[model samples]
Target: MQLRFTTDNADAAVLDVEVKELVIAGWVGRDRAAVLHHIRELEALGVPAPGAVPLFYRVATNQLSQQIRLEVVGEETSGEAEPFVFFHRGEYWVSLISDHTDRHLETFSVALSKQACIKPVAGHAWRLSEVKAHWDRLELRAWIKTNGDWITYQQGALSALLTPMDLLNRYFTDRQVEEGFAMSCGTLSAIGGIRPSSEFGMALHDPLLNRTLEHTYITGSLPVIA
Candidate 1:
């Protein structure tokens, strides 16, 4: 799929990028206790525990979108705010993306559930090299609309999860991420527990640079027939 991105440089040129591989990295919390807590949280909803930590799930590249609206099969779905990394022109660029998923399908297969919904990504990105020194200081926040009001959904620092390089190294041992490959790093725990929402908003903030990458999307549920 071809994606348009704006770099953080002074010129801020909009470049067209072609991506072929898409991956979703899960169970990537830096704290073992927190990771287990998340596992239990999902288990309570009938989702099975992952077989391993930082499991990588390959998804279809066509599921990626930059649209502000998404339509899914049912209401049992939610979004996760995460930092997305992609290799382009010999460099890795960082952006914000939501791992929107179907909760109902997740109970049976997490991978399939992820494939059930479209992934929303921001149009702007920052070169990893520009923020590598202060990567841990980056903050991720998400909000969900409930009862006509937007409320905090998730929020945390990048420090809470493994670094991008660490994730790439674990998934692709002995070599760097291949060109045109993109992955969404793990996410933080939901502020008020995971739940479905019609409107979702997410942002990645760089305190040092005083800049943020954000995207919001509205979801419409398609009727389910027996």
Candidate 2:
């Protein structure tokens, strides 16, 4: 997929990124309890502990999508949309992505669940430099449309997750994603327990800049034949 981003700086030029690969980075929360809560959920589903908080999963580049299809019934799904970051032209660009997963498969194979569905991504992004200074001023939030109303599913400051520079230094020290790769920086715990929804919305808000990058998509499920 192609991502187009513009900075809050009116003089900055628009950035066009050709997405080549996706690495769903997980367990990247500042609050260890938040990270543990996710691990515990996976454990309940039978996924073994990895002895770590931050981990990475290679997702097929084709699985990336602007819309998501839920192709199974027994699948318990949830959207872990967070502030997505990628590198380009000697800088990092920020966007939004949902690490949509099959909660059922999460028990048996976190790897398989990671590959099961198309990840949802926003079409627009922002320059990381624009927000890096007041990084804590950035906020991330997600909502699920239910019963004709938008309900808050997840919400928190970007500070809750690792900083973009740190994540890059630790995992992509060699600039693995330098040519253009995107990763979801973990997520906030769901307001309610994780559950599937037919529609989802997400946004990255910079109160300091008084700007927002937002998008919403409808989820369609295909059949799961047993």
Candidate 3:
């Protein structure tokens, strides 16, 4: 994927990132109570509970995209705003992304549901070191369009989710995160409830730096012929 990198002191530079590995880190809430709450919430929607907390699901690298529009098989998909970390040229960068999933398929297999939609990533990113000092304060938020209006979908501080280092350590116990690797951290619960929408917006805000990375996309549902 091609992304633009910008730092506080440097100009933006566009680089091609060869992401050889892609992993979706799910059920990564730092608070066990909150994690259980999310599980129950999914259960209410017919989605089964995860076999383990902080489960790692490997996805195809080709599923990553930087597009403003997406097309899914049906209207049963929704987006989750997440903070993603990627390694390129020996440096790790943080950015915002939406882990859009097919809700219908989620009930049968969470992993397959995730692979059912394109993962939309922000076109720009910040060096992880730039936000590491105040990582907990960084905020993740998302919005969905419903009934002809955009409404708050999900909102919370990054503190609610496990830190990137913690996730990397758990996934790569004996090795460092290889170059050309990317992972989308877990997301916050929806403001009202999880539901499908035609449009979604996501953002990662650095309060200390007074800057934000954002992306919005429209989902076009194709007919699910029986």
Candidate 3 lDDT over residue span 165-193, tens digit each:
88988999878778899999989988887
lDDT of 3 at 104: 92
| Candidate 2 Cα lDDT to native | 0.77
- Candidate 2 vs candidate 3, lDDT winner: 3
Sorted by TM-score (best first), the order is 1, 3, 2
TM-score of each: 0.96, 0.88, 0.94
> Candidates sorted by lDDT, descending order?
1, 3, 2
Choose 2 or 3, whichever is better by TM-score. 3
The runs of at least 3 residues in candidate 3 whose Cα sits more than 4 Å from the true structure, single-residue gaps closed, are 1-12
Q: In model 1, how large is the Cα lDDT of residue 217?
A: 96
Give the distance in Å from residue 224's predicted Cα in candidate 1 to where it truly belongs: 0.8
Per-residue error (Å), model 3, residue 34: 2.3
Model 3, position 178: C-alpha lDDT score: 82
Find the candidate with the highest TM-score and give its number: 1
Model 3: which residue pairs collide? none
Note the Cα lDDT for every prediction shown. 0.92, 0.77, 0.88
Q: What is the lDDT of residue 99 in candidate 2?
A: 83
Which candidate, 1 or 3, would have the higher TM-score against the true structure?
Answer: 1
